[model samples]
Target: MAFRRYLKPRVVPQEVEQIVDALPHHNVGSQGYDPWGLNLDTAKISFTAVRWLYEHYFRVEAHGLENVPADGRLLLIGNHSGQLPMDGVMAAYAIATNPHGPRLPRTMVERWFPTVPFLGNFINQVGGVVGDPKNCGKMLEREEAIIVFPEGIRGSGKPYRLRYQLQRFGHGFMHLAMEHRTPIVPMGIVGCEETMPSVTNIKPLARMLGVPYFPLAPLVPLPAKVHICFGEPMHFPDDARDEGEVERRVERVKDAIRDLIDQGLAKRRGKF
Candidate 1:
C-alpha cells in the first residue's frame, strides 16, 4: 500500500499527470484498464520516457494540431519512416498536447510487434493494438481515435535513396474509414528518414530473424529535428464500394500528406 502511494506521485511527474488526467479516455473500467490493456498508470509512466525524445532529443515541431478533433471516432493517417516507430510516437504526443485539448489515440501496430517479448505488452498498455481491420472497426464504433500507417513496413523499411517517396498505400484503411464513417487527419512527418538513414536492407538477416527487413543503419536514431504537419480532417462518402474508387480516395489522402511533407521540408532550416 505504501509502495503504491510512493509509485504514483513520485514516478509520474505532476505535469504529465495533469496531461493524462485532462484527456478524455473511453471504455476504461474502474480498475483503470481498458479492454485493449490500456492502464492509465502505465501510460503516464511511458509518456515520461517518450516525452524526452519528443521534446529534447528529436525537437519535434507540430503544426495544424487544432485540425485534430478533440473527441470523435477518427483516423490519423500518416507516412511512416525511420527504422523505429518514432513518427507515430511524436504524432501521439502532439495530439495529446494539442492546444484544443488532450486526446489519447490508439496506434495501430504491425502484427509482428507483439511477437517481441515485453515490447508488445508495453505497447498495448500505452494504447497500441494490432493493425487488424476488425480491431479498427470496433474502436471506431466506440468513438475511439486511431493512428494508421497504410504503407506498413514498405515505408519504414525503405532505404535512404527512396526517402520522402511514399510507397503504395493499402486500400484497407480507406475501406475501414468509409465503412465506419471515420474522418482521417493526414499527417506528414519530415526528418525521420534522416534519423537512421538506412543504406540497404538486410533481407536475408531479416528472414533469419523472422522480422521485417532489417536495415544497416545507426545503432541508435540520430537526433534529427522532426517536423509533423497535421492537415485538416478529411471525410469521404461512405457509399464507395468499388476497389478503384477506394484506391482513388486513398490517393487523395496521400496527396494531402505529400503536400504537408513538402511544407515541412520547406519549413526546416537543415537536417540536424
Candidate 2:
C-alpha cells in the first residue's frame, strides 16, 4: 500500500483596513475647515514629529529653506530617492521648521499608500493626502502649500542603475498649477539614495506582502548623511495661456529640479 500524505491549505493574506479610529474624524468634504483642516496647529504638530525624528535619529541637514514661500498656494516639486518614504517626512519637517512663518506643506502621496496597515494611518495623520489630480486641485483651491514628486513611485524606487537621474514627470501637476495660478518651487533631496541603495527587485515577495513594489537595498541602515536643498521658486508665465506654452513652463520646473540635484550631489561628494 502506498503511503498517503495530507497537506493543509495555504492561507492567502487579505488587505487589512488600517484607518485610525482614534484620530479626530471629519467629513471628507470638510477637509478645509479648522477642526478637520490644514491649519497652523496641525502643521505644527507634524513639524514637531518630523523634526524630532530627524534630530534624534537621522541628523539630516537642510539648506536653501528660504526658497519656500511664506504664504500662498505653491507646488514644491522634488526628487524622491529614499528606500522608504523618509524623504517626504524630512521635507515636511523642513517646512514645519522654517523660521519665516513655518507651515507644514500638504504632501500628495500614492493612492495605494492609504491601504497599507500602520503606514497608511500615520501618513494620513501627518496631513498627507492621496496624489490624485482632484485632491491636488481641491487643496490648491484652498491656497494650501502642496508638495509633489512627479516621478511617483518610480523616483522613490530608483535602482542603482539610475541613481540621481530623474524619471519622466507627469504633466497633471503643470495643468493644476496653471489652473490655480500657483507658483512651482523646485527642490533637490540628496543622501536618500545612499540611505538605501536599491540593487535588485523582488517582485514575488512584494506581491505576497501586498506592497506595490519591493526593493532590495544592500545598505539596510542608510549610513549616508542626508541633505536637502531648495531652489528659488519658478513661476509659470501668466501670458502663456496656450497648452503648449504651459508645458514649456512645466519642463522648465523639471529642469530646475534636475540642475539643483546635480549641484547638491557635487557639493556633497567627498562627505557623502
Candidate 3:
C-alpha cells in the first residue's frame, strides 16, 4: 500500500480519447506482416493505452520531434535506463505520439524480453522483435522505423549512481545503417534513470530467473517525469564498409547522444 503513493495520476479519459482521435490513421501492416509481425489493429489499440501512460501518467514531454524524419527508414538509437521497461516504452510511445504523423517504431527487444509471459506477446503484437541481425536487416530492407538501445542489458543494469552515464555501445547499428543507407536518429531519455533507481544487482537471483542483472530497487517506480530528445538524423554512405570507419561512426553517434543527455539534464534542473 505504501508504494501506491508512487503511482502518478492517470490521464483523464476524455483527453485520452481526444488524443487517440487526433492520431494519424493509416494501415501500416495492412499489406501484410510489417517488418516484424506487427498487427496494425493490435498496435492501434495498444497505442491508446500507451498514449495514456506516456502523456498522462508519466507526463513525458518530448523535444525535437522536428528532427525525427517525417518519413523513411530510420534507426533510433538511445540510452537505455530504468529498472523496468518503462524507459523503452516511454521512448516508443513518444515516437508513436509524434504529432508529425506519429511514426510507431519497431523496437528491437532483447531475446529474453519475449519470454516474459503476456508482456512479451504484447510487445510482439505491436511490432517488437528479438534483437537479431536478420530481423533488423529485414526491417531495414523494408524501410521501417527501428528503435535500438546499443547499450543492451548492461545499460539497463548499471548502479543507480551511474545513472545517465552513457554505456559503451556496440558497433553493429552503424554497420546496419551503412548497409541499408538508412539514417540514424540519436535520442536521449532523461528522468528514466531514477524510475526504480537500482542500488545493486541481485546476481544469483537474476541468474536463477534467467534474466540479466536483477535491479534491487523500490517495489514501485518513482513518479519521475520523463523527457525524450531526438537529435538530428545522421546518414552513412551505403557503400562505406570499412570496420574502422564503422567504429568511428558509432563513437560519433554516442557523442551526439551524450550531448543531448547533458542538455536535457540541464533543462530538467536536476530534479532526479
lDDT of each: 0.92, 0.70, 0.78
- Where does candidate 3 clash, by residue pair? none
Our model 1 lands, by Cα RMSD against the true structure, at 1.7
What CA RMSD would you report for each candidate?
1.7, 11.1, 5.6
From the highest TM-score down, the ranking of the candidates is: 1, 3, 2
What is the per-residue lDDT of model 3 for residues 1-272, given as tens digits with 9 covering 90 to 100?
A: 12212322232355544544454334344553443566544555566677767767677888998888766789999999887777778887777667776766778888898888877776886778899888888877766788999999888888889988888898888888887889999998898887789889999999999998888898887878888899999988865557777778888999999998887887785444
* TM-score of each candidate structure, all chains considered together: 0.96, 0.78, 0.86
C-alpha lDDT of candidate 1 relative to the true structure = 0.92
Off-target runs (Cα >4 Å) in candidate 3 are 1-35, 239-241, 270-272
| Alpha carbon deviation, residue 84, candidate 1 (Å) | 0.2
Question: lDDT by residue for model 1 over 15-48, one digit each (tens)?
Answer: 8989888889768999888988888888888788
Q: Which candidate number maximizes lDDT? A: 1
Q: Total backbone clashes of model 1?
A: 0
lDDT tens digits, residue span 141-191, model 2: 767788899888889877877988988888888888877888888888877
Model 3, residue 111: what's the lDDT? 85
> Better model by TM-score, 1 or 2?
1
Looking at candidate 3, the ten consecutive residues that score lowest on lDDT are 1-10
